[model samples]
Target chain A: MAVTMHDVAQRAGVSIKTVSNVVNGYPYIRAETRERVEQAIAHLGYRVNVSARNLRTQRTGMFTLAVPELSLPYFAELADSVIQAADENGWTVLIEQTGASREREAEVLSGRRRHLTDGLIFSPLALGPDDLPLFDVDFPLVVLGERVFGAPADHVTMNNVAAARAATAHLVALGRRRIAVVGAHEGEQVGSAALRTAGYRQALEEAGIPFDPALVGEAGLWHRSTGAETMGRLLDSGVEIDAVFALNDAMALGALHALHARRIDVPGEVALIGFDDIDDVRYSVPTLSSVDPGREQIARTAVELLVERITARGEPAPFRRVVPDSRIVGRESTGDVPAGAEGRVVGIQPGGVEPVEVVGR
Target chain B: MAVTMHDVAQRAGVSIKTVSNVVNGYPYIRAETRERVEQAIAHLGYRVNVSARNLRTQRTGMFTLAVPELSLPYFAELADSVIQAADENGWTVLIEQTGASREREAEVLSGRRRHLTDGLIFSPLALGPDDLPLFDVDFPLVVLGERVFGAPADHVTMNNVAAARAATAHLVALGRRRIAVVGAHEGEQVGSAALRTAGYRQALEEAGIPFDPALVGEAGLWHRSTGAETMGRLLDSGVEIDAVFALNDAMALGALHALHARRIDVPGEVALIGFDDIDDVRYSVPTLSSVDPGREQIARTAVELLVERITARGEPAPFRRVVPDSRIVGRESTGDVPAGAEGRVVGIQPGGVEPVEVVGR
Candidate 1:
């Protein structure tokens, strides 16, 4: 009832081996032969069960990178970096957007896409400490970002706590005594928001300044508009602050917008700093000062770790966490820094995770 | 000898059908049965060739959307739109970034990805007329953008030339002459750049203004930095212009940056307009006026056309082109307009492509 490879070979007047090669996507096959085989396959309505074939071959030559959303500047640029790294390793990346839902994040672990790729590179935003067990799945996975901790998989991340502290310290060094923090998640016990907030408080304590809860701005989303909205509230509240530290660059840009609307001068009246040195920061009106978390290095390390896991698939390998070196990329948004600030590593101390030999830029 | 599903079924101590369903990712399987089958699959090291299985089933329930880059807000937003469209139709999108390379675009068509999906939605950048015939392939393809012309496939595009004409004419009607156009390609005879330039010229002819070649700014890449770089050159060249019509939003924002650097009064000294009406334009200082090219409509049409092609895969379907209606969105950057400018449908006339019924928004 069904057409087979033998029928296709007979229809094309080619050998079974040639038909198999054509169906398998062997690039070196002659064009004429390939076309004839393709025609026969089409004529016969022959199908290639890719899943079955991949099971036999034991290699799909494809990997997947799942993130919250590609529209976000950080994630979009990170996806591009991941693609570059995947290309270097002779693999293609299948991207999936999880909308930052815990359920959806869990689905990605056991979803059909899991069976489609050789391995996965994930940056979870919604999954929590309770969902850590989901990381113990059969597939080779390498975690990314600061959302998940103690997962039984290789992790590639940056020093979020240290970086955030150094970012706050930069503002202190710029002679700003009253620094307001934007994008603080209320009651956040984990994730980047919590870690970065803790780091900010640590810097304040070290500088002999008391941490003021009223100065911490709340943002449900780290988007530019949210940043602007939160900053607007802070400004309207009559908060006495000479400087602002946004959790991310998008918010910093948004805060700049709010400041611009209010006729406030940047680095003249109030200085602003952000994390994640996205490309937009470089081109911003008064280029944004940000914590460069070594995104490229993280991308490269994630891909490489996934490759190693895929290679050593059956063996029991120790779970390792990698924290790439990070620094602040000072720009005009922060007043004139002393010369030779370029390539200046910000945080000298390590937080919880031991340094796996920081790959300095 | 190779292990088989029958062997996996025996080892898992389940019915062959249960093992088959588990391996095929049918969701109705019991957890105990699934775990047993997974263990058997792992012990046996089974590989499910995805291509072969997809061929046998004659449907992968997946499609791919290829664009130049996702980091570009236009493409990134466009990708988000396509993903939304695909999701509504019960399909997943595999995004491929070609970096606008002709070679990369070709590779997507003939590469392994072709075998992994049922259809493709392609927005080719670096490809040309010579490569049009390559669209005549075995699979279903719906082309997006105004890059390639006369391709014998379902084409979903916007009225680039007409939209550009209306944008330019809007500036002309505002009593602004010597309007410079940013993001012009040097020798492009096809694609959006050339068509948009032609539209700008038509508007100039109607306005009794001579087209100035010196006012055409050259940009190899339609990026903010490139836009800024080109605008900087134009300013340094001492080209006196009262307004600017950047080809896209990113370039418009870049031009805005360049103007801000020069401390030039926006709208008061020089009005600026752009196309694409991306989200950033709304938040831009002295917000941007842009041609709303119906990106959401374009995305919906492309995905729907792709579905139609994929559904009618065996038969020869007549090539169809869908051009959605577009209009200009006035904002702060273009300064004030006379009364009744808000609802103006910028491009009312149709070009060579017969207007398919516009799916009303």
Candidate 2:
């Protein structure tokens, strides 16, 4: 049987409140009393019942993270990083999938089940700035994603616009003109699709290259299938493109498949680049080049922000944006040369090529 | 502002306890009083706070599922199914990754964080039968995995021994004798590795084939890299094998990579099979053949068991084993058909394959 606080108090000849005070690090406790309680705790092996303590404090010491889907490797990796960060801070995380639906996203922020958790870290895909009022709850929330423009909460995200520009610039640096963009959502003014498209255009304009409408492929979702289908459509439409920029790794993989089916050699006939440096990219057939969007930093920042809000005891922290930098990871997919460039490999770009367009607001 | 129970009770001219009773559907409330409370609830738009009500009942309406990792697609998909099942029962799920550490597994069952959750659905890879006593705590728990034997709590898992036999038998049926087993844990006696290895031997004996020790490859971890490395080691050891069975999908993928490197024609020169029907298998080059261990059913059953325990109000429900069936999903990798037979998909095994070996001593 586990030892109770009462047992520890009895063993130390101190009041149960004194033990509690010591355990909670109450400043009023004398050093000798604290030392005695601590010694007794170690001797009796009295581990505090976090649940019982939570009842008194009305805090569960647990947080909830709601993402669109985990089947997507990106989110799966993100969740893994978040859990690791949360564990380091002595908190447990509950995971929920909103499936990128507005209703589900709203439900998560409603706080109807707030008692089950101390706070929430939400990544909404469908909910936008128009739904900002839904976040007006009494719980601490740290939002991730570009779907919601100005939600009232702490947000940790990548510089989507700048990152997209960097990816396009990398392809341009490889001397590939007429770069095609895959995974753009039609009629959308914000979100990842719009932001990445804006960045792509920004890079092309700076390079003095014409922005060709025929080079833009519309993808409803940034999924592999969508990317493949869009790439096929772009080709079928007779777009003259020597390079491709997929919004994410999944789409990039899909593009690779499409190009393979058409016997279009990557970086030979056309260069390819993707976003989100997913783990699989390293092991891909040609090892895809992608953008590393500081995922580790985002996870740590989100957890720390949520923790600050929880510890502040109702002092609402100002909504702050954590903009992490993104770097291009050059691999064979981008025609980057093999490490031992002894002329054995043909048509390979030199390693560490500079960006064609500089990053700026 | 959200409406509170107080508003409903005051409007209904009844005490808060009466409103609580009505909301909870407690027996013995007068019919007219219930009717009045219901009307007041609807009029005031008072949605019951699930978390607060759980607090009053000393239950959290939340269960925690601890797995080794989420970066693995199998666990991520399993978590998604579990969350879906829990949501259907008006419950929430919390996720924790123990990294297959015995110490962390012990902490989960320690009951120190009981207030954060009602029960736990744990999948332990490191701990075994010797640690069962550690699970004898106040809170409820359901164990998931083939690692532990004779656990006191309810067990939910795939029939690893039987499934492995069926997988090997499939290879035997294909006229392959000298089959290699990848991803075996050397010297394991009772975990999934040991059980699967025993099944492999049983299948070999039944086929009147000698069990070649050199044919078994040991992997430190059941990952794709390890699988690939083990396959390479097996080949380097000069083991002439006609077929290979990987313990899991990741290892199988690694094995595929190894075979490709060696220029072995799959199904023509050597047939390859893997366990765990990961989503990526369908799109993989040559596509992978694998076993579907009814993970969806296991997730649903675990969630159902936890929900029952939570609603039982301290009543101890009898523990039972949920042994879901497994079947082979044949793809191009198995060499079941000629190349370009993409559309000729086979159906799931009828009556589902039963476990070949039952441990009922």
Candidate 3:
């Protein structure tokens, strides 16, 4: 026989309403009464029917987090952070792997699976600023990444351009001339590739160095293999380079692998830096220099924004555009530093909203 | 006005039954009629109420994938593979990060969230064979990993013992007599730690080498930092070792980092091999040697088993246990190999059901 709230209430010697309140996590109930109700429920093996509660509340207590791919360390870490933040808010996360397909990204925004989730936290890779019309859906949505700027939804991003500039400027301070940049999406006018490349150019201009198109390596995907292939091509092309800046840590790691295979000493022959200070950077041989893009802040802010939109009772607030602060983190990949010593900040960028540091992991 | 099935049917010039057939993906509908119905659905902006449909069908078309953590490269790659496989079966996956907590793992098995998912694919860490009774739940469950063996549920695993022995024997064949094993759990009787340790001892016994307790480094968590700390402790303890066998690649990478910090030349002062041939192994400075544990096969098999259980209508089949084949993959971490040369199989284990190869990435 199935156990019911009535059975629990009878066993606990409480009213059915009291049992309901306890099950719903009402905080005002007496501690002794709540304990008795909880004990009765456990003794009776009473399980809450989440679907029934969701139907009554019109909220599934679940939200979707759509990402490009979890195999990528950056996205995997971002998803992990988002799941942790969402768990604190009493929500389960359903993951959707869009594989960076434009059609699939559009399907996610179309509310095709709206019946299964209260809202969505999307990190798009394929759908760009041109797809702003799709963001006008009747659902709580928080967009991540620089793909769709000025979309009709709350957005959480990082200081991509400034961070990239800091990374490039650091290499310039090291007296690196003929610097090469990996993971350039040819002719891209938006997204991380475009913004980071723009920052690279800005840093070069400030250093009185002319931007050389030959030093830009085109990589379709920001994967380790692509990074390695791009670096290998640049080396094979006989282009004299003193430093390399990979767009992400994965690509930078790949570039390191390529350089090692060619017997090119990192920091001695060609210094290197990567974006996204992922955990992998610390374990890389000559621990990688990278940019801390404030991934945890981005995730927490995105979840908070989506939660506000989902639980709003009256008129919706104006959409917000949030950009978390980012900073450079140097290691042996860029220049030799003492073990366990925090890398000295060679150049600091102003206008950051938060204090940042280059702590050695 | 909200568009309904009637409106879609009217616009498609078809009966409501035919429209429902098209929406439900019934295969018997004519191609032209299905196209017309889909076009009508798109034009009318009609969406399926998955929750109401779930109530009628008693199936949510969703499943839960519970892992210890997604930040770990092994679990992240496994989750990516599982999501791809589940998507092919037309199901969505809700992830539960147990954080290796016994209470949380037990709660998942207790059917607390059963109402939201049709089945579960759980990779438990804390709970073990002693908690076999917990697996006797009224849900379609498929377990992964070596934690809870012989539990009353479908299981998919790898050749832990044989694979570990192969890894250890490979190090021994490299003339490394005093090999130190990392990631050992003190006094563990089950799980990967114990099973892999058993294999290490077996290899030593076969080689007529005595097992020394001093060379075993204990790590509670199979994380990179833990691996590094364990290795640092082992090195600091004045233990003479020529080889290291880390239980996992993350740990092996960490151990490599520790070795580098001390200026120990890989394949010179020490040889190392790790389990789980993760993508990181290839990018590691020395290109770590590792065991390929057939992760993709395990994921596909687990998903297929759970799907079968969920869709079963008649008498249930006996629960099955699956152990995929594993092979050792060598790289520069063990010894120098020509670039792009397939890793030579120094010693081969005969029990692998499937033919395996040593391919260089």
**Which candidate achieves the best TM-score against the true structure?**
3
Backbone clashes in candidate 2 total: 1
Candidate 3 lDDT, tens digit per residue, A1-361?
6786767878998765578678877667999999999999999999876655556476778788999988899998898899889889987777777889898799888664565678899999999867765665556888899888777678888888888988998999899988999999988898999999999999999999999999999999999889999999999999999999999999999999999988899989999999888888888888998988888988989899899998986555777777776768888888847543345444444323322121211
RMSD of each: 14.6, 14.6, 15.7
lDDT of 2 by residue, B22-95 (tens): 87777878999999999999988889655434454666677888888887778878888888888788877778
Q: Candidate 1, residues A242-315: lDDT per residue as tens digits?
A: 99999998888888878877778787888999998887766666667899888998899899989998877343
Q: Supply every candidate's count of residue pairs whose N, Cα or C atoms clash at under 3 angstroms.
A: 21, 1, 0
Give lDDT: candidate 1, residue A244: 94
Top lDDT model: 3
Which pairs of residues collide in model 3?
A: none
Q: Which portions of model 1 show Cα errors greater than 4 Å?
A: A1-50, A53-58, A313-317, A337-361, B1-58, B312-317, B337-361
Q: For each candidate, what TM-score against the reference?
A: 0.79, 0.74, 0.81
Off by over 4 Å in 3: A1-58, A339-361, B1-60, B339-361
**What is each candidate's fraction of native interface contacts (fnat)?**
0.34, 0.31, 0.55
Per-model DockQ against the true two-chain complex: 0.18, 0.18, 0.29
What ranking emerges by TM-score with the best candidate at the front?
3, 1, 2
Instruction: Return the lDDT, model 1, position B130.
Output: 78
lDDT of 2 by residue, A1-361 (tens): 7786667777888755467568877787788888999999999888865544455376677888899888777998898899899989988787778878787788787655565678899999988867765655556788897877455568777788888887888888888888999998878987889999998999998888898988989888777678778888888788787999999888887777677657787778988888888765654555678888878878888899899988884334457777776677787777674521111111211112111121110
